[model samples]
Target: MNISIVLILLLAGAAFTFFAGNKFASKIALLVSVASFVFTLYALNLYLNGADLSCKSIWIQNPKIYFSLAVDGLSLAMLLLTTGLLPLIILSGWVTKFENEKAIYSLVLFMAFAMAGTFLAADGLLYYVFWELALIPIYFIALLWGNGSLEERKNAILKFFIYTFGGSLFMLVAFVYLYQKAGSLEIESLYALALTETEKTWLFLAFFLAYAIKIPLIPFHTWQANTYSKAPAIGTMLLSGIMLKMGLYSVLRWQLPITDTAAKEFMPYILGVSIAGVIYGAVLTLRQKNLKKLLAYSSLSHVGLIAAGLYSLTIEGFQGAVLQMLSHGLVIVGLFFVSEIIFNRWNTYTISEMGGIRSQATKFASFFMILVLASVAMPTTFNFVGEFTILYSLYNVNIGFAIVAGTTIILGAFYMLRMYQQTMLGETNTKVFADVTIVEGLVLLVIVVLVFFFGLYPKPIIELITPSLQNILNQIN
Candidate 1:
């Protein structure tokens, strides 16, 4: 199957949902998400069978780019992440009382469409366009549907918008510069670009600025907590669950090979920044009163280590990062949706106001406990394998770096257990507490099953991803 159909279906789905009116829009969107996901699985099978899935048409003449799209192991893994979470995202949105339901539903499909394009793009300008295209739908979703005072919402969304948009401009400049240097924006052509050490360093920083701000690494991460806090829960899922992976993916795809010498030159400092962010994010999570902000901060800590693994430049590191990206994407969607469920039932976001959910909702507590353990990288969950691989890679790089980064294990446990205890274990704060409805249970059950399934046997993904990372490493050399 041509992967372009996946993009076309998503875009078409968006338009159809926009005009389908309120009553049917959400259902149509969910159906479309599921259908696209099935096709992705087909595409993955075709790819493994040695069928060619890459296709391109001339997109521009003078600049020499194509509307090129292709899927490799790396791209397919990320594509799975995008397509897999989408149905769950849509399912979670079903509980939301969105104003202008059609617009919101349509925007979501548009976001998925753009992210899918990003993973598959075989051309740099095409990748950039899709990258920026993703920001718009989420922008409106946060600004229009988010819960906050109008001014507060505006401030948070705008910071997120401006910070990310500004970073994207740098990435555009780096691409443009590379295009001018190589006379082509095709991924392979740029990968083969010959630049002086100085030029590559500049390109490295330019791309890093973009990916860091998007990933919101460390100080660049100021935008994330506020934005995640204010955005609607569905939007939060898109951001944490999938959007953030774009940076880690970009590091593997764009920054690492293109800036090989520069990356090696600055490897110590770069890894230091990443390790610092891990500690920084975990520290901040300890004090958050708001549940969304806690998850947002926790995401930072996890991604910080994931980014560090990619920087470690080992196949095991890359393999673990890719798997963790998928695992984190699944777990975060369940986490945010749980927070949303809490808010839906109790009308509160503050931790102090939550308690005794376990007393009434054993099912919720069971599922929630699994996710909490997953976040903390417990065995028999997907995250444990990924986290182990990453820490092992870091240990190879430097024991001290590994030690610092390992703090996430402890810190993740600390905050997650505390949050679970305060929210689910203590005395009931209100009269009513309900078990997860069927839809919510269904979504989280998928997450739980996948988490365990992958952890027990991650060999398939590791084998698929290792060759791609090897290819990238070959390019870097």
Candidate 2:
């Protein structure tokens, strides 16, 4: 089967859902997303069996671009992450009474289509196109369906759009330069091109500017908290769960190997900045009384650690980053869904306003507690494997780096437990709190199951990604 089928299914699904009318939009979107997930699984199966699912053909004759899609363990991992979480993200919104429901669901499917393309595209220009395309649907998703006053939403969304878009222009410039020097925009072609130290450093910084802003590491993270706070639950999920991974994926896929010298040269400085983001985000998360903002900053902190691991440029770092990407994606979506459930019931995002829900909503509290533990890297959760590997990689680089970054685990446990305590463990609330509905319970159950499943047996994921990561390391060395 052509790997492009997954993208076609989602793009077509988006169109179909939009026209299907409001009555069936959510159901249709969910069905299509699940079907896309099934197709992705089939592709992964074929890939494991060595069926060669990649496709490439001419697109533009002048610029010498190709409509290319390639699969390897790294890209496949990302593809799986994009397709896998989408159904749950859609299903999480099943009970939401969104105005213009058809439009909302349609955009979700479209965003998935673009994110999948971003993962699969092998040609640099094509990858850049897919990367930018993923932004459009989410822009609308946040703007139209977002909470907060209209002015607040507008300002936040506009800032997010401008920051991300502006950063992408640097990436476009880098791609164009690569094409000029290499005479093709293909990944292998650029990878083969030899460049001077000066050239490689410039290229690395250009790509870093783009990915850093998208990853929103430290100084570049200004747009994140506001955007996450104001955007709708699913919009926030898409951003946290899948969108940010684009930047991280591009780092391993494009930046490191393509500019190996510069990556080695700047490793310490970059790692330092990343660890600083970990500290910065966790400290800021501690100060948030708003649930979404707290989660947003928490995501920022966790993502910084992922970025640090990837830039460490070790095999363990690469493996850990990929695993954590998947783990964090699932866990953050679950966390955001928990927040949405609370808001739906209590009509507020204020952490201080919540209390004693555990007394009434045992199922929800149970689910939320598991996610909370997972976020803090409890030993039995998938997060523990990823976090342990990442910190191990940093330790190899420098004990100080590991020690500083390790504080995130300590700080994360502190604040996350504190948030859970204030929100769920106080005296019984005056208002009634219902347990999770079947749909809500189902979504949380799936996430929790996957978290523990992967946590216990990460061998499959490790075996799947190892060879591909070794290949990237070879290029870097």
Candidate 3:
């Protein structure tokens, strides 16, 4: 598929710029990211027109794998999201003064390349490779450029790597066992395999382990807040915005359908824990005094609900899960960026020290308020669509599930609104606080526009994804 072109261009551009030196790296990365985004737009047009955009080439003969990258509406949506965010991520860091500017931009582009590849991969081995490839660049990005003491940053980033990588190993084992039994690595081929309920359960847990750590379900989530707190803003954006979605997307694409019988069997336990995460994360968010840590907990809370929607196995649930993924991706990027701007001015993350920022920077206050509202799933925001849909799906399963899960909105509002009022509304002792600069303003504006745009008109994605989701749903049954 032409979707592979995006990944190819990103990686090649990254390599070229790594040699292009600091003077040219950022420009090259931006242009390449723009080109990739344009190509995605062209591909999306073709896809909407019924063009054949799927491509597969034999890359391994023994144990059989393919350089198989396919983009139906589902894959294309993710590809578009990946490419769309790249230029913005690169541009977002334009003002940071780093020692190895070339390396920084290069790693950012490389991260995009890996993620785009993950979304496009249509073979198990190919997908696993792309999945692991994504972890390398971000690890260095956080380790070298991250804030906090070196020992602390190293411990946090290393824990993140080991925790996630360890889970991925189980996933690899599942894939290998699948390949051994099915004798092909094609995703569809593996999904079509008729396995016993017991076998399906094993595969389910294997895939779940990999996804849970990344999505960071309760006990599996210890690495996240620390990692987010320690990483640079750009690194945090990459983690919260795009990286978390990989697991959620995998749940939609691989885990559920492939383990359909087992998923049905374990639905209650899985769904229970996911819903529990919603409450757990929200309660912790209430206690957090660090700005970034609050955001970290907020992410866990939101994603927990999304995960519940996925396990609900209803059409509305899938719709909500996908829409919320996009919404959260856009919202978190702006939130983390907002944190960076605040830190740049105040040189502190302690929420107790921040007060009445709005009194000084009214423009920044307005932007921050809107993002905070979006994060809390306020009415008329993009998040509302997904959160409501997901909760409705939970209602389909059990009114109680929906009722319990719905507390996220209330708790989310309590924490986020309280934080916003404290940070931006009250009274700042500072003589003056700087407002958003041109680049920061542009970034927030783009995010705000998408929040309202999708909030008002999320149907395009529903239309695009329905056929693919229906196809998967059919297979599961």
Candidate 4:
């Protein structure tokens, strides 16, 4: 195992700041997060060069517990998203005024460590550990920093925790069952163990339950809107941008191959659920008054489309799902961050409370409009590339499903344009609305460039993930 040591360095930096004073603490956290971001890039470079970074250490030998860390093309892509987004999240947190800056900064860094671990861990138990570890920091972040009724925020966090954790228990059972069969906790070992049809069926359901709740396919998604609305913007960014991808990634790493038969057998039903979610979420977005809730539903709708693509059970669908995952992550992070800007200046998130920012700040309105367009899958945006691929892939499966999925384009435009118009156009509500700050403009500009860059030329990412995607697709019976 050739260790990258980036994780080690990040954890070390976090540990060092345990006793640091308030003034320098945020600075320390910021520097460490930025460093981790650089190291993440380095890790990606290593992966691109075909260097393998797999390491394992025995943690609980009697129970066969082991700490395993590794990265592949898929995992590397997620790791890059996780690390790249952290610096921005950290910066966003910094721009906000917090009462306990030290604790807030420390908690954010800790959250970063947990997220990084989630992407890097290879052992089932280790992955679960990192998976649960992520919830703790975020729970606190929401409870302490969220702008909402205290009890309501607490309840939302508690509900979010309970729902996800409850699903994970079944996942734990599935892993234990696999351990009994494979005699090891390593993912690769478990992946190789042949299971009877019945066993695969039950294990797949267990895995599906966990991931479904997380990606939050309909009926299981009650916690998403409330949580996203109550939590701080950065918290919403983390949950939507990268954490939700945990489920999609698991579909590749665990579900497709291990439960190939079950997946194939139930493909239509899964696709149906996804389509329902897409429409349900979009229609609900049309009725939302809060900007955060609107974005939450929009994300739900987008994830549904990705899930539908994954269930298409073809190479095109699989690759499109992967691309969509990356595209969505980047787009949501930018959108939520921009929301933070709007909320900061206007001191409100309700669309009804905002009007006529277009004349006041053309630059701000323009950038927000770009993000809006990206969210709506406009041509020359990353979302367009992802959605096109998914639609094409769906066409291969069933033209009907593809046709249904295509409505998202129209639905998305309706809601996004409506959102922009309500918030940025019409009579000026206040005489004091200011343009985006320098830091804010830079952040928006960087995201906009990335949105168009990936949209115009996605071949590089598609090419990078091709080999691994084929490997996963081949495992599908």
Candidate 5:
């Protein structure tokens, strides 16, 4: 079967899960997601064994649009990340009760469909459609199923919606402009356009606005912490684990190639902002008392470094960015799941309210400690591999930039360790903190194992993504 089958299965699963009703909705959703993941693996095998996975068809003759989908090493890696995490995301919420549980599960699958589409679509307009489609499910997921006071949730969700939606309009405008000038909206056509520096600069900034807000870089990131805090664990997982990657992916896939000259011209400034965000996010995390918000801010810091690597416009930079995206996605989900487990036990997210769980629940604490170390980029974890590569790329650009960005490791370790101490260490809590349940243990184990496994032997992933990154670098150069 073609790669499109992955999308078809997920969209179909969403519909079936919605109709399956609440009693079996989660199970159905999990099954469908797993099926899609398996299909994606089959697709990857086909791709690896020298098969062409791209498909294209006419949609709008006048605008010259096509229902196009393409797969290469880069897109395949993202597809794997998306499909791989979906089953875990589903399982993370398995026991949590929600209003209209079937609907929640349905939305999750639908979001997956959109995300997979976003990764696969090769036509510019088609990509835009999938990009915006992803926002709808998450909006509802956060709005309806999120926690916090009604007004707080409403305000946070609205801000996130407005920021992302507004930013995307600029990207849409860029796509329209590209279509007008190039007479086609396919990615290759946009890349081929011989635009003037002035035109390329405008187009680059427009696309950057969309991606930055989605990546939520710096000033654009105001919506993130509150939204992460307000949303339920599952919603937060989908957002942090998969959604933000769309923006970073787009940077490599769409932005830099289409605006290569402009990207080169603006590299220094953009790198400055990204490195600044790294420090900014890490510092902010140091002050957070709320567990979710702290993790949220930490994500901001990590992604900033990833964005910097992409902007560095080197092969190592691209590889590091992709690797970190996967590493961060898995580790963040595990951390959020841990936070959810704590919330389930204590019914609170306040850091000061937790302590000494290590004494009672060694398994839970061990899992958490591993995830924490991964977050801090411990030597043998995937995070270290990704972060070291990224820092090395930055050092190639400017030693000062590398030096500044390196602070993330130290600052990350400090705040992350401090947060771990307050939340998982200290005297034993009076409340009984049970060890991880079987399902929870399985989830954490998978994440931790993958983290270390990739860290130690990154050859396969490096080899998988190298050619795709080299192609993008060629386009940029």
Candidate 6:
């Protein structure tokens, strides 16, 4: 089966959802998400079983770009990540007490479709269109339904929208240059072009500025903490879980090949900046009392490691970065949702103000404990595999870098455990508290089970990524 149908199906689902209203919106959304997940699985099977599914249709004949969609090992991996987490994110929001649930539900489905389109689009212009399209639904979601003080939330959302869109302008410039140089706007055409060294360097910087802001590497990270902290739980999940990967994916798809020499030349400085982000983000995480702020900081630290991994330019490093992206996406969904549960119950997120929850709900405490351990990269969790791969890559690149980056493990444990202890281990500060509902328990359990499952057997993903890594690395020379 062709994968482009997935995008068509998703769009149909979004339209159906918009008309379905609140009563049927949730059920319709769930069904669509399940179907999308099935399609993702089908695509995976095609990829692994050696089926050919690349299809292209022209959208802008003048630009020579097509509404192209392909399912290669790399695109398939990202497609799986996009479609897989979506149902879970939708499920999390299914239980949320959102106003105008129909609109919210429809928007979620739309965002999923947009993300899937972004991942699968093979034409440069088409990909950028989907990339920008994905941001619109999220902007409204964050601005209207987010949790912070209204003015603060609006400011944060505005800043986030502006910062990312502003950065994307550079990407557009880079793409225009490629179209000029390659004589076609197709990504493959651009990949095949042999640009002068000077041209490659300039294009690389343009792409780098765009992605660095999306990844929000240290200096460009000014907007992330506030945006994440203020966004609604599901909005935050979409931002951290799937949106950030867009930037990283672009690095592999466009940046690396377009300017392999530049990547090699600037590896040391890029690596150093990434490590600095790791240290800087972790230190700030340790100091945060707000649950959301802490997670935001932790995200900074995690993405820093991924960035470093990519810059290492080793097969292991590239694979590890991909694994880390998947791992972090899952863990952050749980982490943010857990915080949402707490906010729903107690109406506060301050660690210092919460206590004695172990008695109130052993289930809550237990689930929190599992997520904490996973976040800190306890040996048996999927996070451990991500960290191990990244650190192993780092060790090969530079042992000192790995050692310095590894300190995040220590700091991660300290903050997570300290938060757990303060929030769940003290005397019963308040009598009224609720254990996780059955749905909450089931959600947490699934996440925990997957964490352990992938941790124990990452062979599947490693094999899936290896061919793609080899393809990319072959081009480096």
Note the clash tally of each candidate.
Answer: 0, 0, 1, 0, 0, 0
Q: Tally clashing residue pairs in candidate 6.
A: 0
Clashing pairs in 6: none
Q: What are the per-model C-alpha RMSD values against the true structure?
A: 0.8, 0.6, 1.0, 1.4, 0.7, 1.2
lDDT of 2: 0.95
lDDT of 5 by residue, 1-477 (tens): 678899999999999999999999999999999999999999989888999988889989887899999999999999999999999999989747788989999999999999999999999999999999999999999988888888898999999999999999999999999989989998888889999999999999999999999997998999999999999999999999999999999999999999999999999999999999999999999999999999999999999999999999999899999999999999999999999999998999999999999999999999999999999999999999999999999999999999999999999999999999998899999999889888898888999999999999999989999999999999999
Model 2: CA > 4 A from native: none
Name the 10 consecutive residues with the lowest summed lDDT in model 2: 71-80
Candidate 1 lDDT by residue in tens digits, 318-424: 88888889899999999999999999999889999999999999999999999999999999899999999999999998999999999899989999999999999
Model 3 stretches with alpha carbons more than 4 Å out: none
Q: Which scores better on TM-score, 1 or 4?
A: 1
Measured on C-alpha atoms, candidate 4 has an lDDT of 0.86
TM-score of each: 0.99, 0.99, 0.98, 0.97, 0.99, 0.98
Ten-residue region with minimum lDDT total, candidate 3: 424-433
lDDT of 6 by residue, 130-222 (tens): 989988998888888888788998899899889899989998998888888887777778778888888888888888888898897989999
The per-model lDDT (C-alpha) reads 0.93, 0.95, 0.90, 0.86, 0.94, 0.86
Model 4 residue pairs with clashes: none
Once fitted onto the true fold, the runs of candidate 6 whose alpha carbons sit more than 4 angstroms away are: none
The candidate with the higher TM-score, 3 or 4, is 3
